[model samples]
Target chain A: MSSASPFHGLSAFPATPANIDGRVDTEALGRLLERLCEAGVASIGLLGSTGIYAYLTREERLRAVKAAVECVAGRIPLIVGAGALRTDHAVGLARDAEAAGADALLLAPVSYTPLTQEEAYEHFLAVAKATKLPVCIYNNPGTTHFTFSRELLQRLSDIETIRAVKMPLPVDGDLPGELAALREKTDLAIGYSGDWGAADALLSGADAWYSVVGGLLPRTTLGLAKAAMAGDVDGARRLDKLFAPLWQTFKAFGSIRVVYMLLEHLSLARAELPRPLLPLKSADRQRVLEIVEPLIALEGGRKS
Target chain B: MSSASPFHGLSAFPATPANIDGRVDTEALGRLLERLCEAGVASIGLLGSTGIYAYLTREERLRAVKAAVECVAGRIPLIVGAGALRTDHAVGLARDAEAAGADALLLAPVSYTPLTQEEAYEHFLAVAKATKLPVCIYNNPGTTHFTFSRELLQRLSDIETIRAVKMPLPVDGDLPGELAALREKTDLAIGYSGDWGAADALLSGADAWYSVVGGLLPRTTLGLAKAAMAGDVDGARRLDKLFAPLWQTFKAFGSIRVVYMLLEHLSLARAELPRPLLPLKSADRQRVLEIVEPLIALEGGRKS
Candidate 1:
């Protein structure tokens, strides 16, 4: 099932550190990207949900992409998220990412007015035509609220540059069955993104683990990803157990909130999430500290 | 059940016509506002979902507001939609609308990373505090994806300027029960926005009918609203029947899509919905024309 696509294996999604005023803190972002490169994840998913791509201005997003390209320096493939509410805006973002040296573009049907299947298909086609960079269909319904029907996916797959799909974990919890169904419909490379389900997704032969936790603790997460991808069931489960506590916190408070706290705790970045997304309260922060203390040892596996 | 709140009665939500590149077509927008004024809608709901507030940029939104203020010329109370994905952006919109002479503000908890109840509360509180204008909670889950629990509504009602709520129709269809429950919690003037349910919502003694059809055919919609408000069941039902076919189109295709087509068909504006939202196909356009033909005569009761 191995393929040459960059949307394979573990793709680490790092939080973009930015000031309260929405200015990108590129130096801190570079430190995070540099760690992912040294740790040798398959790809870097920059400006993802955890990266607050929706909250940042276009200027800030461009600045972040420019900085990420310089920091990675082709050490790893960089997949930049280019989602916006309007199609033209998204096309502009796709072009900017391509010109700024993004290896691929991850696009979500980010909607305010919920789109019809035809509208979503047309949007993907427009962005796909905008750049030569391969595009991954970002099917994140939890945030974007636009579900991609298989028919729509099949139609989009016909577009030359739509190379992959990043799917949310299936509600039925049958990763193998969902993967089989999706494979029958389209030739696009398939991956799954809920962090707690990463081991199972990989174990069940998903092409990639679009991971949020891997963004902060790249070395530890990559170890788990490798074990599962290699079908070392016991090894993968053992590492999954180490992450069980963090996953509980992630489930309780969203992964975006937990990841920012982790970045600040590790002193990799002292970034504030854009307002409206407040930092965890003191009691919850203390709880996170307690849960993460034992797992700190696992984060020390960087190549440097 | 009635007060002097501008959120009450038939508050017509007109489309803000904009060019394909997201520029506000101020002259076209002024034409729409002027009609709403001549027809004497209770309040003008500018930059609503129909108005494409979520699609327009800040400068464009402010420009739309300035043009609306000049065109409306204080003939009717003006309630402007001030929704944005980020809280700071929403605050800026609210301030801009206030400075540009809006009579009230409609804020929805528009989200990218779905918000916690507390986060939504704080977001609304910040915007409410930022402006002196009265605020209407825009509880539009179909677009914003943030549903308000009654507890959240109760908490928000405690804010002085938070004077009203524009609710979607309840799933149970028991507008009376829902209204009673909401009324028990707060004094916020409660209105409903799903157009097909407008007759029942007003007939149920709800404070307002936030009508989309009213945006274009103000006299006809206002007649229906007046009948329902005055307890003339026969008159309201008769008027509601005239709109039955149009409501069907709204249900089949969204009200936003249908309304944009109507605006262009009527020669009011040659606006294009910002991209990703394509114009209705020819068959759908023909279907709309046939449905609206009998209804055209009903659009002729303007004051001037």
Candidate 2:
């Protein structure tokens, strides 16, 4: 059943950055992809919320997707972010990404306003119609503010091209029962985001994962995913303990900004972010590097 | 102090609907525009969240703005919605709206992702820079799940074209306080959306009012605004009471659908929304008519 799914395993949402002039640093992104692919990442998620896409122009985003697709060169599955607040634009990007050779799309639910479940269902349907590739629905109420409900999920599954979901634990409502209910839904793999919850969601039957903190410290998460898959509960528990302290950093203002800062701290991406997203302060940056340096080293040492 | 500011006043988010066949019903919309103009609406908000903009294509939205501009015919200020999720797309729409002779723009912050203040600010600056018109910033967190903090608002106001703010009262948050702080900091007119908090915001020193519910009961809302402006607290309170039951209708799901239904019921405009936002059900249809008929009669009797 899993063999047929477009995304079968761990996916890294590669943090994208710009040069001093604010243009996407394609070369740096290429190096990061090379490292990620060499380290055996199954899929690469560029142009995500972590990728600072909201700041880039449509043309810049299109160029970035093409660049990533060229660099990844089919070494691993590449998922592009093609969602906008409007259906036409979202569908347009979906079609563009397909033509650009993305293996799949990490589509966000409708934004800018609270969407009715029916509208959300239709949004998914429109994107699915736009492209032939697999579509991974992103459900992050912590940011998008609209939760693609289970009813939306069930309805979306009926559409043949929707292949997976990115369920970051909604900060507001209860999703424990929601995740439990997801187990009986379909063959579609559910991926966890926000590393603190990854191990738990895996235990709750999630199949794949989207990691921001994982990029900053990969092996700790990779180990946890491996342990969970192998049913090694103790190993998973230890990794979870290691990740628990680092998770607190994401709870502040501009979580995505923080995610990019963490990535930059590890020399994985550029230090700059697009306008409106303030860069981390020198003191805060130094502190983050100090706190997470050991774990990043752990990931570095584990790399083959 | 206020005279020096380029933006400071009331505004109405005009609903744009087609006929049953999806063609822009200009005659109907013209009448609605005339009615709003007659009501002394400070600026006309075209293609906003209430306008069912997400359902319209780029071509359709541009045409809608063009049509609204022609209909209004310089009778009042035309503030178009340039709030697309992507930077270039939104800037493109902003340019088109400006070219169409729109008086101002109402831009929602970055969509889909809870953009960093810098990203949201940049999105605003890019749109503001795209056109020379005064820009009214729209901060509705209920739909976007992202609030532009007062600090962020200050940053946004730095752009010369960013002249105002249209903040809808957020769901489950202190809107009155938020609006008050924003009002104190900038010379921008702070209009209350959803109208539930309009009276309070006015009492708290808000300069203007905006609402979908008020569009449904313009007489009552206008009466309240007039009364509040005249310091007629008792009279203002009276109109607020009258619109309460009617306000309950727009508070639910398909409120945008219901707005079109009422506009049709009153013969104000056509009863069509763009695709993806379907018409209401048969049973709900009956309930809506039954619920608002008396208020319409009561308001109509007052007019005659």
Q: Candidate 1: which pairs clash?
A: none
In the range B240-285, model 1's lDDT, one tens digit per residue, is 9999999999998888889998887788887888779888899998
- Residues B155-259, candidate 2: write the lDDT tens digits: 887788787787776555675667667767876777777766677667656777766765555555567777776777888788778777666766774467778
Chain A TM-score relative to the true structure, per candidate = 0.97, 0.89
lDDT values of the candidates?
A: 0.91, 0.70
Against the native chain B, each candidate's TM-score is: 0.97, 0.88
How many Å off is the CA of A266 in candidate 2? 5.3
In the range A133-230, model 2's lDDT, one tens digit per residue, is 88888887765767666777887877898878888765643445756677568546778787777777676657787877545455566777778767
